[model samples]
Target: MKLQKGWKLLSSAALAVVLALTGCSQTAAPTQPGTEATTGQTPQDDGGQADMTAMLRLNLKTEPPSLDPPKGFDTTSNEVLNATMEGLARLDKDHKPQPAMAEKWTVSEDGKTYTFTLRDSKWSNGDPVTAQDFEFAFKRILDPNNAFPSAFLAYYIAGAEEYNTGKGNADAVLVKAFDDKTLEVKLNAPAGFFTHILTQPTFFPVNKKVVESNSKWAENASSIVTNGPFKMEDWVHDQSIKIVKNDGYWDKDSVKLAGINWFMVNDENTQYQMYKTGQLDKVSSVPNDMKKQLIDSGEAKVDSDASIYYYRMNTKMPPFNNVNIRKAFALAIDRQSLIDNVVQGKQTRALAHVPYGFPEPAGGDFREKGGDYLKDNDIEQAKELLKKGMEEEGWTTLPLVTMTYNTSDGHKAIAQVLQEMYKKNLGIEIKLESKEWKVFLSDQRARNLQFSRSTIPADYGDPINYLELYVTDHPGNRINYSNKEYDALVEKIRNTADETERFKLMHDAEKIFMDDMPLVPIYFATKIFMDQPNVNGIVRHPVGTTDYKWAEVRKK
Candidate 1:
């Protein structure tokens, strides 16, 4: 009760709180997501004398899980996909959706239907891009056989969830390509952020003809067909991927650099050395040990990132099945100190999962308006909760516990810090385990892991993007959390139509989730990295991935 007074609203077997807000239609122009970055440095005027042959070199911390847009849910893959693929709409530097493949579009007066008019764009293979590509892409993402984790992004389309969950036929999904250049999509209801959500790579149109002919079209450069500013020239598996400017692109004249050579180097120290030696123009991460010094010396840049680093406990398993235990674990960590002393990124201490940089549906900052849902490092409360949970489980001795995280220097350090905090606060010693990224994600989806490190970067601007995954058995809901009330609140938020009322429902849902404490949120992310002096025009969207579409390099 330190922040907002969140009281339980229940009376045996009925609804506790009556939502007073009336439903009103969502405004046609919704508030856009925030896109504040360490940017104001404009590109230098080279008077058409900029180097056109050089590739702007950069590093990725790890190899992407897959280059296929449907399977590419992680940052590593989507960062590359965002550069190579063209969606009907793309978020510009302002973080507002703008026309890309689609030259123009219209929303029905009721706002439930969308019609896109495509431009004459050519794929990297010189094939003309058609509306069919989009129709195929949308259905492909929602296809259960594909098992794409981001498939929920398509649930906005009418009948999509039914088809995705194997209950309805593909033909029932209401998205169709009327002709070569026109496509139509009908949603279950009006979502003002529909276009904003469409800006994601999951919505990027793939060449239907190419994909039908080759299953591994995105795996290698030779088989790839992209319609964006760049085309893959070579891919060396876990080593590197090189992309060159696509001359066949619809707006090829706007592209500046000849290409981008993305090197995969997971070790931050090695990447830092490479950047120092001029082998890399930009680094994906800063060594945790050296971050404070780098930030203090003005050598590193901090940009706002809409990501939340948290811990997920399997709600169906063991001692954590107790709500009090989950809340105890959550309150044990000192998030401010973790960010200030250990992480050393200018990240915001997350009191809620929605994070900053997102606008509430009606207007105003969501995090600020939501108030603090989770308590900050209340050691006394944590101890009380732990004792209560242990007694409630009828055990003087606790079950064996473990915390799992994927392999990374920073991750290992964070786990160690958290382990010590838990021991100090609740007198619990949890074992720590590290696994390779693929194995880690596999274990998480299988529900084989007990307690694990988890993070979520908002896929779109809406707060529901952060809240909806927990809906009963949603693909992204790996924690096995299910509550009838919370699910109903989210369902209402999705279809409510009234922006302010919807936001209230979202906030109410989050309050219930935090009170249940299935997961522990640590801090919201801010990207801290170093860049070469000559690099320019890189647009890093807070809601999406880094874009090099308008990037250029000045001859030094």
Candidate 2:
């Protein structure tokens, strides 16, 4: 969904005011362990377990695809790999931009250039992480042959587009190493949210020597290097991956946990069972049946995430090419009912393109700003649109369509709800297909699967992070949706330095998308999990990395 030009300006101004009031310098650093108090005792000492070492076990749905920071973007991989790699910037409890490996930075007045002063950090292999490492990592990911799905993060960098297109030398890009500790980047245009973008792993510096020396680097557990709070110790693909605290980490003294064991369990039933048996620390996307059990046991804790689960129609296909049909499909489903019944009221219904609390912009109601385009449950209107679409296109029978989802019970239940809704409300038949999570992800990226389930995590704390996914030519635009007007607005927001003007443009662009119904809004995710009571300092950030850095485990 696009934001209106006027709203974009107002939103930007609002953000600026909020940032100023909050005192941007007070932003917390990414997860760091508890440090000693000025009183000469560490925080962990209060519990009389100053030397205690705890092992936290996690149950994951799938193994990470890769440990290489530059190549890992998928949620499964990101959750695990993020603990091992340090980015130039980190997302704090509020998902605000903060320092990480880079101690501080300066942005030019034109907003097209950023110079960062790096902290003296060493890789797990004892090699110094220099500014050149970042330059090399950035250029390599932009290589067209690499087919990095996240190349768009660097598109703002000067010469990045040419480098990614194979039209210019990779070294010609804006990133440069002034020395071992200083790095500079030149952007093609002003990008207001560029600092937040740097928090992504794609921009994280890597040890060039380590990656080049190992031919199978990042492919397996042993071939990777760690620069963050933890180091991967063992990885049995599709089974479990283990990590231990990194003593070599710069702030090792603050790290309290000794180890973490991540188990890969695809079945929700098995995961729930593990948690019940006290073998797992946390499990997300709990099943309907298990929710009551966890709640009764006082183990259920629900956290609302700033993510949207939606179904994208392949606009490039024949039947879906018509916008009316797309709107009809959108209007047919009852989003509120879906949230209440299918999701068991665990999630909130999405009305606007931007999910609430994202970037937590001040003084603007996104729902009101969405205008009248937001689709609500109206079976009669949907049928009318569908009838007109079929008549205009010379079609009488509904097309045979397949709705795909992951092999989890929750997804299976959701797909069934959609299938029943489409058939009963619109007389449209939709076959349900479920595949393994990895296969489903692959199919989505290739655009080979139609009408599939997808979720977008907030990259930064901004609405634009989610909005940009729908931009024309975006790698994540799996539905092949392209609107020239929307594309133009996105470009304008990126280049426009005026904060007020940028937000207005984005808000207007969002209205156009909500009106088009290129995607069927499902519900905002509600993550339910249970953690030990001793897990303190584990603040839940709605966006970005979900890890424990500032947290310390104290004995009860």
Candidate 3:
């Protein structure tokens, strides 16, 4: 799912936890079946006490490599981490920023600084959460030795660049704990979406004491302490992980479910069978063949997932460095046909690098505004470009390039289709490689493949997340694509607060990238999940992990 954009507030729950300085009194009513039951419940008058504790079974393909939010790439781990840890702010159902660990914040008139006031909260270990934790986490991520993928999240923070470069002390970085409860942030420039960035799990606080106590702080489940609604009850690598509600949480009343049991099962058919037998509470990434059966039986729910599928070319490689080669490859593909035949109309054909409904200019669509840059398929043009590219590289024929994809049936099918299309339409020889998800990620990060399929889920409901990957010197620029002009436009967009001017600059930058075809636009994927009728209150976010904080299930 994509990240949420705007501010969204919360609603009160039926049960409340009485919190005092020393401890809390556990007194809540028992929950019903087919519902998100409570953990700590009071005895009822009928006959026997009801079981307040409920377990949610989730189907996952793989276990997260690390629970450390800064070091992992698995979305499953992100989902669990989001529940167990909180940031200064969080996105609500409306995709707007809402209070989480920080009760409120203020942006300076110049928009270069933000100050946040923390709420009186405690970690699962009962240690008080302070602003120092945030400072420590931010500095740790910025450390070059750590080499966290999420280090970019703090790049915009004031003085982060200097700190990251080892040119300045950690204390000089933009983040500072004004006192035990208050925190202040400084930015290099006016960042309009800075608060939205705070909602991401990367910005969550990490206890200094906890990290020091266990050098492998996030390596084992026992080493970490939760500051959000849930805590890791049990975690077995590559097997299963269980999360139980943190009864000591500051906002414990809103968390209804007692716990969630996440199972790691890669086989799609096995997961489907488990769902049918009521062993799985929720299942996503459904295959195309079963869509009809599930829909006909009224068991499947479809939503437009905020995931944009695309293929990135390793610009550091030989032919890919040629713009004509990249453009020819982009134009040769029949996106609509792939969407209809390969994905079975489950996805939307992507017109621009950034998909539609991503908040671009109002007067015209991105493609229309793009002019010649949005050129559609032309077999003759693709053939001409390929001929020129091969001749420029002093070759009679194109090299046998490899395209790597994740080891899913759907991904394999798409890869085969792409291979055939390029060979037939553009006379380009291509090879297909499929690997496990984890292996594929590692290989991609290491730039081991010539061309790789990737998807970007919006971090804060902005187009910049997709565009920034190609910026000069960006660590996530795994393909090593760089353009000075493109970087200038990106910087301009970031500095400009005027929506109209910013969009114009953004569109211009997108046009430049499309012209070069650093990444081929594929399609926006649609999320298909299976949920029983009793399931309710689960809101799917467009950008980040789906929010289940306020969700409640009720039996008919």
Candidate 4:
């Protein structure tokens, strides 16, 4: 998934109006402690009982591949990075951009330039945070040599994509620090959602001194220097990670919790056991069979996530190189059955690349206007398409294909269903393979997989975010799918300021994309979990993962 949060407001002027009218009621949440926790800060024995209120214990779905924000693209690493890093702006409960290191910022009338005024803040090591740090970070993200997976997010800035793609020079990219306290940015075009882009961890500044001295600075707890509300205290690789409140934070006085302990447990059943045994305060994944039971017992929680799970076919590879072949696989799957039998929750069946929920600007929803492009299961039609595609290739029998996915119980189940579906419907046999999340991503990027499962949550609440992924050279376009018409439409949306017109172009583009069927859209995701009632103040974003910066463990 493109694991970063994004917001879609009309424009910079409208954003200011909304913020001023809303009265900042979303001020930081006050941290509080529960009477006891499953695990947390080292207990100073009060006779025999350990005081748990001062600590929070949560389970991570997977061990983080890397703590370096730019390189970390999975939800597991993103969740950890969000708590331990501070960016120019942070998202409040409402997904609106809130002040963080940058006390306030303003955009020019032309909407091409942004000026940010910094507040007094320091790193965990007590060194003053400066505007220069941000300048360095933003430029580094656009540096081709860095090979940042999320470099596309910063492309809105002037010359960023050009610089990152080696078409322009670093100095030509218009991000600069005018002084110790002021940072200025010039964009190639007007960007209404740019502020929310800064809330992503990829935009967070790193301590220049610390990162320069140690190549693996972020990988070790002792060497990391962050400016967020919490700082890493210890890390037991693949076992647990411990964090303590940062005393040097600008708003330290407002923070209440002493520490948070995150345990690494990939199995949902194990996490459920830990929560039931009172060794964890929050569990992210609940066992599929136990989902209903946990919710009935008032232990499980569910929230609609702005995400989609899909299967990507390497359009550059044989057999799949034919568009008809792609359409056959996409049309063969019974998405409703997949959701009902495999992915039970509030997950919506995805018939289009962009999920439902984003506004259409004038009225209604963007999805309401576009409607469904992909159809439900049609086995006969799928068979005809596959047969036609095979005939075009002048082959009676094709090589066996393999579908790949990350290691997980739910993923395994979905793969099996698809494997059977294709065999029964199209008379084709495809094998299944699973790898750890990190390995799977690397293999997918290299286009080593013939067919594979891929997912993307909106980095921001816009149709363009999802639509842009299919552009000819987009970093996330791992399937090697490309179309001139699709690329033109994406560019049109980015440059057009009128929402209604942009929506029409996007809707048209989506139709063209579905017609080609480079990827098979499955079901949209709904985050389901179980947690103690005391886990409070976790700000949920519309995109990516939730924010734990203001989290508290208040006694219920």
Candidate 5:
């Protein structure tokens, strides 16, 4: 209660709670699950320049660690990669695949072969982009040594997983360049969402020559070679990255803004102030106190994200090793209270792992069909479960549990609220711990914490991505959760071509996941942001991503 009062006082004063904030503590910049190292110092000018007025000005939640496609897994790097690199396909406003680098293609009747023909395109450095570039980039990502996080998404390609795991020869890895313009791929099985998979940044091509000639090619702003709507023109570490329109882009004529200036402002208050002072034209998020006011005035926008915030229990660790104990914790959390009092953003209470908006092949949303799996703040049931779990374990007293999370003001507030909830409802005390982003991920992957705050963003539009997370062998299954039935259903969903059957398998897998109570579902997130009035054509997807390729800035 005291902490909540203090936070309310801070908000009432238009101030954020003072919290420790630091970039990834690596000597270099931090790296997220699917991203590269983000370490670089501000660079002096390298001759490339563009007019400021012609550039779109926006603020970044944090500076991205690396822009290399294979390692660009996080949202920050995705923003730059989406703008500066062209994949074989890109997502349209409706989140459907649209042609980009590849003009057209065909698949074999067996649904195992794909042939892609490259369009006439050149890199920003005037080098030709060929079918070999795509072939090389794909092979590089599948290389066992690289171990890119999203490499599994490409496992549908014949020999991809084998090559990635070093179980098969690289030469047998099915992707081949038939000519300067034609590329062929053989898949192990047909993936209904394969085209959408190509739209991911990890599938974007890299110039083999540029990467080989200079290993640090992507680190420097000016030397970075790209084949997209814009090219990196300048980068000042911890300050901003500047990109300008690429004259050599295949569809350069459609490019609206000549450039974009992306400022790295991790502090929410600083970002809001910059927007207010006209130093920034847009911010990815706004202060909670200002969110409603801005929305009421039509200066802010809110959109749902295909994401779920949850807490993964360390099943391999004590106390949580019992399923009933896990259920007790899951049932005790007051998701509505957390959202209404703490988050104060447009967010929906999450009863299941998957968010509410993801599409189902036959028709409606996944969450709508599955319905709620757990009730809210069932204190009596929670206490009963805790008592039963203790009795089962033959313990007279419960052990102390520690909850860990990455550092952020908002996260701290959320953690505090949860701490109080558990203490109040279950009489179980939770010790809180904080670490830098990279370290936090490292610990989570190693299962070094008792309970950890975590989230899974949908890699594609499929519920399988969420279901696959807890599969016995999945690397993303950080909690070491495993159930034979759950694993079998996940595999069944992949091979079951029938949409109805696949949906059933997916639901069954989720049911097993929830029954085990390996994780506590908190809330489905929403993006609430503020943008300058004149900014037009910006595409904000409920996926929590922004596509600026077609964005236009016009004088009002």
Candidate 6:
């Protein structure tokens, strides 16, 4: 079944979905907790009393690059935005879209238009959230000068791409505010995962009045006003941030935690120590050496992450510019060993470039259907490919290649392992470089690294979400990979409405992508965290942010 309204999800190794199509129907309204089968999350039943003064203390890992929703491109900023804002729709525990700011929405007969009736909601600053807010926000995302990384998403909205690319007038973009409460949108084509993607950070509405008054409204807590369950209380740049529960929230009763104290701690060992000493309620990063012990002792929890942990080979750079060299380097790594000995049970060897949790029309896992791409330990083939690649480049010695990773204990471990693997398999020595998170992201976006360790989490639930990353010069395509045929294939997939045909095209596209070998597939990431038993109800979606809306820290 195609992704649509009234869909029921059945989980297998990945996902199984049954949904309705060919209809103009009003989506189900959001129900209060305990009223629906999946209401995002349920508090853990450890027989502990609920803490009256509830606050979750966790590490954000790094300073968020931006608090402005459209510019909050990194995961650190994504988490902060997820807690501080609300979008038209929010994903339930089952990964199904539920009414959020919009009380209900209706789709057009052709599935290319959507009309949303927003519920009565107020910002922390006491302004009423209106449809005009959404209208302004959508256009702000598509403004060519803004260059928001997520602008491509709004391209589905009729004329949005034209405006974003400076080829059309902004007034012609098919997003409009019919009134104070009603918003309408027209799409160039049907996008089945539209609602799913709406849960992303960039889709959240911004306060136009506040922004107009202060261009840097999102720069500090004093100027920011949020419509979500929480609002920023304080931000001490690069140190810590404190968000307090928004008293004016429309659904304040459902929000359990009083606030979240987000600390910026880069080292896993320090984070784990903080957790052990009760300075933190939950810690997502811990020393790699302690992962298995913690998991085995039931001190930590491991959840599947719908993300790919891989190395991006700059296709425009030397050595990797040769397809054979790219494949050779990709196939040299022992991914299973990396997972088993280093990352522990926190990850599994990725079977394909697409991580998991997407279901095909015939109810099979997308990964299972596509099969594995590169042989992880193909040493002889890797050596041969390296020789041929060097020959093709007319070089007696390979170019100076460096593997770069963001500074982290686990990342350092993985880089060391890969370095040894390359030396053992391809008889090549490569340099390793580490940078701070912010610097790393900046340099990577600039395509400054030759080979870089990278992890990509799905922006939405769908097979195409992963495949669309390599589209010609996409902002997300940091590796600078460009292939006209692959770009055309993605275009065909985007325009296609049929489930079987789309999946078939996606498979073909993946084959082409793997054959080109722009990036090396390492493993599918897993969320490994140690939480104090009393800290419960935090809903961490496989694709999106770790939600604090339904969370509570119980009294011991």
**What is candidate 5's lDDT per residue for 1-556, written digit by digit as tens?**
1124224513423122212111111111111111111111111223433222567888765667578887767677889988999888877766677788999988888777889999999988889999999999899888878767667777778888788877986788899999989999888776777887888888999998998788788887877899988999998976789999888999887787888999877677888898899888677677754555565566675665678888999898879999999999998876765665567665777777877666677777788788778886677898999999999999888888999988766777778778767876788878999886656766876668889998677777778878887877566788888899888888778777778888888888888889999998888776666666556556665543478876666554
Give candidate 2's TM-score. Answer: 0.87
Full-model lDDT for every candidate: 0.81, 0.71, 0.71, 0.76, 0.76, 0.81
How well is each residue in 362-381 modelled by candidate 1, as lDDT tens digits? 66678878777666777788
lDDT of 6 by residue, 212-274 (tens): 788889988888888998999999999999998888888888887889998999888898888
**Which regions of candidate 4 deviate over 4 angstroms?**
1-53, 296-298
**Least well predicted 10-residue stretch by lDDT in candidate 1:** 12-21
Per-model TM values vs. the true structure: 0.91, 0.87, 0.87, 0.88, 0.87, 0.91
- Tens digits of per-residue lDDT, candidate 2, 165-283, equal 77897878989999998999999878767888887777777788987787578877777787888887988988988888887877677677887788888877788788778787556
The alpha-carbon deviation from the true structure for residue 59 of candidate 5, after best TM-score superposition, in angstroms, is: 1.7
Predicted structure 3: lDDT: 0.71
Off by over 4 Å in 3: 1-51, 292-298, 360-372
lDDT of 4 at 523: 75
How many clashing residue pairs are found in candidate 3? 11
TM-score of 4: 0.88
RMSD, each candidate, Å? 9.3, 10.5, 13.1, 11.4, 8.6, 10.3
Lowest summed lDDT over 10 consecutive residues: which window, candidate 3?
14-23
